[model samples]
Target: MNSRDDFTEATKIKLLALAANLCSRCRVMTVGPTHSGDQRNSIGVAAHICGAASGPGSKRYDPNQTTEQRKHYDNGIWLCYSCSKLIDNEETFHDANRLKTMKANHLAYASTLVGVALMAPFEVKNEIRAGIIEATLALCGSGAGKLDLTAVLEGYEDHLKSIDPNYEVEITTTNRKVRYDITAKEGFVPSISIIPSAETRSLLFEKFENLRLTGEDIVIPSEGIDFVGIDIFQELKKTNPKSVIILKSKKHKIESELFLESDKGIFSLGSFQSLLKGGKRVQDYSGRALNGLFQYNFIVDLENEKGTMEFGSTIASWIGKKLLDIKHLPKLLKAHKFLEQTSSYKFTVECEIGNTTLKIPKGIQNQPENVLYFFRRNIKALYLLNEISKTLPIKVSIISPVTTDNSIEIADFSLLLASKPQPERLEPGTLLFNSRLDELPTPLAIDLWCQRENLYLSVTEQYNRTSDLYGNLISFPRWNFGFENFTPVLYSSIDENDRNYIFVNIYSNENTTVAFGLENGNFELL
Candidate 1:
């Protein structure tokens, strides 16, 4: 492989004699009947079956082959100048059987190689060629190191030129981008770039100063990113608009990490690199591969012991839970924001407000199967806060409608207990009831401001039940009553005093207790 492995003198002599001093394809024997000078010295060229070099663009350069196997007598195929140029144009068509068939047919016509013994039937030859072409196409995709890239590209270019003669390709590989520019005669230029993940922002940093050179180490610095003129980590590069962010993904379970941490990770290197690097196409990754560029890799790094895998499993479960559960959380963004900050005791929420969204993070536990019900009994406290916002002296309860259609809301008890109003600055206890509305808010405003807190108001329209048969004793200045958001289940009747008479029966959700009846037709709240 280090040097050119040409054929033996006997093999070369036999090939030249078989050519009979003529071009192989046309079988012309000689350019002119009695030509002299340089033409006689070079009648035909002894082409190698397998190519001479090792690269993607090289012809028949299988990496697995030894030079001895490649430079054998069977490897030589004789061809004239014109046919040699045509055969070497694309490595895809320059396969073993294709060349064998051409040499056999050419000799069969002129009867050059082996009388008629060496040549096989043409149909049988095409059948074998078809099989080779099929296998080559299949292997070209996943065969890893196999197949010639230049040959494939040359064939592709020939097809493109058939449609447009001026079709041209330009490829540029840099640290920041790998651009492929295709120019067509039809006034169109399509371009694409492949930004390698190995050069992306990553924890694994490379230091040439620390490059530990061993005795056997071959330094090929020219093949790296430094060859390109552009330097990375520039402010302008970060500001440039990007649509794709390629990241490396590794196969989990076998390895210690979730993704095989290659220098190729193209996203989320540092905090500043992600500042203006905004796009919807942030999450796509390469195919599954083990180590280098294919087969298997990991996404997260694991730091635990053998089969335990505690850290990796914990990270995986957390990711899975977030992916599946957070999507189902109530659609309220505020609820999601609040839950994102919470670290302990996950809630099994049952929201009463219609289609509310709440995002909850997975954290601490409630042991013994670890389940906690969302305490919705306090949600009515939010409505109470709403009343506090209007400065209406009201005690509010949720109207659990019996028939779904009767969903109208009315003030349950707008009874002003304090005679002297304080609308300018309501009771100091009202400080807890701040925001009147939120998308999906918790209703624990009873911490500071509620009738239960400071007790600035205590007013009920029921009859004063202190006296035995005082019929109806208490009433508001004026009243128009309805049976909606009101709490206690009560029966009412018009008394002789024309005061509102009410007898309480039952209490429901968020309204577990009934308020006191008016004492002596006098209301004072402080």
Candidate 2:
């Protein structure tokens, strides 16, 4: 019941942290400073669940204050800096209707956070407090937070699906055009348009070039003219000279047509519609008409089967490529790491549609040229995976299926012991070979590099981005480490590739549990 002005800075910070943590746990605020980096000197701002101008008796109003007192976190909802700024600066947020919507959102988030905190044990509650502090500071520009890739991809996919399903999709290449016949299904034939932000026309064209054709065929007409007997004989004379007497009759028509006899056959309007329905036609063209104005014509009726087959093949090839391109999406989860080594680690993993590679500590690797290529490919594949996960009914796993044959052996801890202890009786502190973050002892320092790498791989492969920043310097709490009575929490990885070197308190106690290898330099722990 204390008024906002009566609260101490320390108390305010604690309350803000609690609010942010509650919001984060409820999946309201996914990405922010509090959830991404170390927790210290971080501050979270409070937002009103109801408008600041709401009546004093309202739930959002700070009841402990006088009628003129401004309601803040003491009786309002807490928000990250970005949200606060968005509310204050963006005209949309200030709209009465929007304010009402925001109030509902804030109240829902607050109610959920409170529920989660109440159900959690004291230790977990402390962690939640730390998380909130980190979240708060992150808002105040002191920490970072996790990327809500799951929510992002989900929203994107939902939007894509919500569009009218009957729109016909098409891709045009230098040699051919591929079409999707959506009208045949009795749905609105959507005008062909690609999501420009996600893909480019050139990429789609290139994919079309590699498609494979299947099923029946159709042909294109020449000069927009309907083929007659005379035209057929004239075409025959140039392509097949063996005929002694080329007879022409109005009733006689060529059964097949080829590009070699380009002038003989013409397409009818009905045939044009048929070709489009079959997804074979690209675009309408014209050559000659009654008043010197060329009449629009569709390609149909070939003289040679080979020419018809080639045309169909080209269209089919383009279709195949388009399907593949649509299926794969690139992923871009930010990861960070810090190294003192002149030599770097090059991580490589192949995804469903392409490969993913990264060079940690960029210049630390022997082959720096390959690093960029690796990063680019993986980034692309990750995006594809993220996109595909939205539309397709597929479950992407977090664990990499493509693991080194010696990964199990390499992960074994007994091998690291000088006097091989029994596996069953192995105590904590048993070092697994170059321990990844997961295998460390309970009190060990969490390896940020491993966490980032693993999270990236998991997001790309498993469609799961849930991660634990426990036992790491970044996730360490101020109280547990005997720090300056400040709150602590995990922040986001640095950049997109280096998932290590998280921003942490410079004042926290140094612990060696988490260590990194530096070529020509000693290993150090925070």
Q: Which lDDT tens digits does candidate 1 get at residues 1-526?
A: 3666777788877776666545656664433333445443454777777775676656776567688866775666777777777777866866867777777766665564454443236866776556554443333334423544333444433433444355464434344343333344456553433232454313122321212211111222221212122222121123222312222222112111111111332111111000011122221111221111111111211122111101100111112222113221222222323333434322221111125431111121232211111111111222222323233233222232121111111112332222223323222222111122121122422321221322222223443211100111112232222111122322444776533543432222232222223233232111
Using lDDT as the measure, the top candidate is 1
Q: List TM-score per model, in order.
A: 0.20, 0.20
Quantify all predictions' global Cα lDDT against the true fold: 0.34, 0.30
Error at 272, model 2, angstroms: 6.6
Worst window of 10 by summed lDDT in candidate 1: 269-278
